[model samples]
Target: MSFATPPGWYPDAGAPGTERWWDGTAWTAHTRPPAVVQHEPVRQPYAPQSFGPPVPLPPARGGGRTRVLAITLSGLLVLGAATTAFLLLGPDDSGTRTAPAPTTSDPAPTAPATASASATPSGEGGPDGDPAVLVDQLNGITLAVPDGWEKAKNTPDDAPTIRTAVSYDCPGTAASFCYRGTVSTRTARAGRTDPKAVAEADITAAADRAYEEDILGQRTHGGITSHKVLKAEPVAVAGRTGYLVRWQVVTAKGPGGVVQSVAFPSEAGIGTPVIVRLAFDADRPELPVSLMDTITRSIRPIGDSATSGGVGASIGP
Candidate 1:
């Protein structure tokens, strides 16, 4: 439905007692405290009554009439004061009341620049400090990493599935690292046409391979076990259609490992689709999956950065 009111401030439908901007087509992020409206009591001229024969009464003494007039005027004054007080202090017709002045503690997102910055998602907190913004010129993507997370030094140079990879390890962990998140721009094989299918296969293979190695290392006695794919579904990443793959180990002992990956193709001319994976021990709560999702969704392709469909075309299976 269209806005019946012209472009201006209106009570926010989502938040009562707050004003939101109606930008003709839609409500904008811009909002402010509601405006207060004060009503005043209107004074009407007092008309004197004429006592006719039907309402006959004895004539008043010299100052009796004056006293009566004085008392009547005083009562009118009191009534006027009461009406003014009610109008000033009583709740509005809707039972909602706005402050006398707009609150300034939380300013409105009226500035386009401020709104834009806020629109970009970032980690709530990072160990290194405030979340740091990292822009990958080579991959044409940008994301925010938690503070205190250190980037791994050994990024593979010859991994085919990963054109370039950047891994961040959380603080307070030894060489093995406790929690880790990685962003990689994947490159398909020389003749592979469907990157989505390749990505899916690569994701599955990675999970199986990782679990196999884990079992072989732990089970020197030759007991074989497998990892399980918890979920695999089509997802919209960075405006591009992609897939989110989640898998976990099936072991009775120790901390079960979990892997969450998001893979999608890049838009035309913006290299291949990238995949972001976050892995951690199920026992540790350090791994932030929501932050991982934010990083994956923040990716942007080289020339198609302005487009909302992420870094790639909107094609997925």
Candidate 2:
């Protein structure tokens, strides 16, 4: 039958006992038995049918259930993808996302080490605390305190001096105590710059002060009637070339005494000249002449490692 005929089940002329299903344009293989009619029905006109190969059918329409199932599957796939992403890239327990760790090519920063109080540099105030050492900060030098000697307690702070621990009444005047040995240091006054000249010029005054008279015009060491030069020569002190002059003075009322003046360039300030004066009783067995050499050899720059005075330098005869 042609498409003008509506789609329905009709009697199959080719197979009389059964009815076949006809779509709008063509017949399908579906079939069922003919129903019984209670009375004679009107007959409709039919065109002659030819038997040919069956034609392919188009897709079915109005498939609401199939469309709904397809949509549900797509939604599940999308939800599963979102859940996977969140689990792999979520925040930590702290509620803050941590950055990726640095690779070998990118190094991490490190904090610097802290310094301790004990790490202070050497020689600043190291020797000042030693009882056997005398630190002269103004001249930037240190002297070894010899045996039986101590720092001069009565000396002014501006003046660095040391003396023998023992003292005796002055022979010429009983008003004051006389030390058997004394050593004092000071920056050179505005006079001679040459170390040798300074030493030579200071020796006479040193002798007079030690034995001749005191500042009050009293004979502290009896009376200095004569003086003799014991030694005068160039010496090295605290790594600098210097000079020293030693003199023997004869006193009137007691055994004579020896005096010495040493001058050198100071290593602390602007290379100024420094003078060290020494006085010792000649007759005292403990205050030998060689003690002067020992004390001079023990001088050193404030920060130097050498405690035996200058660089292999000697003073006095």
Candidate 3:
């Protein structure tokens, strides 16, 4: 290595560990070998040096996604707690309420006004006594039972029934043999507005379809059809409403041999009339039509109108 000193090169004191390279513009003694500071090429900031536009910032108040999720869960928990409290305090009303117990001091229900008034006992009617008179009083009205009739008690525990069966064998053609009585007061479902109308309807029914269509089929209608109205009166008895219909029923049993039908009285309740029903085969023309007439025509409202509102056996052919 021959030493050749250029004009601009000299021994370096400041750059002790470096070499000098000069292209002679001025005296160059020391030079830092182009300080190859080989730092990993300093990377520029990852942002555009000149931002073209500003970035929009996210909302800062409500919360981030995770905070929102936490809040929603908390709300649901509160709702569940409220629902549990309501269920704990709510009343159950799915069952029927029990009836209140009756107090011991409650007054006992008494018989109806008509019933109490019409509670007549059985007795004997005279030879001309129309047995159905008491039945009339029991039905819906009070009436005279032809001077000698008496009323008998009945069996059914509810309705008012009085049998006016004759104690003595009545003349087969007697008019007032029996006073079958029937009555119904205000119940869960029955009523009579114009008691007279109810009475008329009942009589028509008995003398017409109820008796004729049901048992007579074509039996001779004797009681009402044959009789002309003699008198009618309003009456009340035994807490019931009723009337008394009096008339003479003409019955013709044989040709030119008509027997004068006796006048008997019948009584029934307005709501339920004493209907006398009789049945006989078409061939049995000799049925006790008189008895039937007596039973039906005799029906009258027995005792009362202030408040409100029979049976048989087989005749061996």
- lDDT string for model 3 (182-212, tens) is 2222111133345455444444443332122
In model 2, residue pairs whose N, Cα or C atoms come closer than 3 Å (at least 3 residues apart or on different chains), thus clashing, are 298-309, 299-309
Which candidate has the top score in TM-score?
2
lDDT of each: 0.43, 0.66, 0.30
Task: Evaluate candidate 3 by giving its C-alpha RMSD to the native, one decimal.
Answer: 50.7
lDDT of 1: 0.43
lDDT of 3 at 27: 24
Q: Which scores greater on TM-score, model 1 or model 2?
A: 2
Using all chains and alpha carbons, the TM-scores for the candidates as numbered come to 0.41, 0.57, 0.25
Residue 218 in candidate 2 has what lDDT?
81
Stretches of candidate 1 exceeding 4 Å from the true structure: 1-131, 156-183, 208-224, 251-253, 268-271, 302-317
- Higher-lDDT candidate among 1 and 2? 2
| Model 3: per-residue Cα lDDT at residue 153 | 51
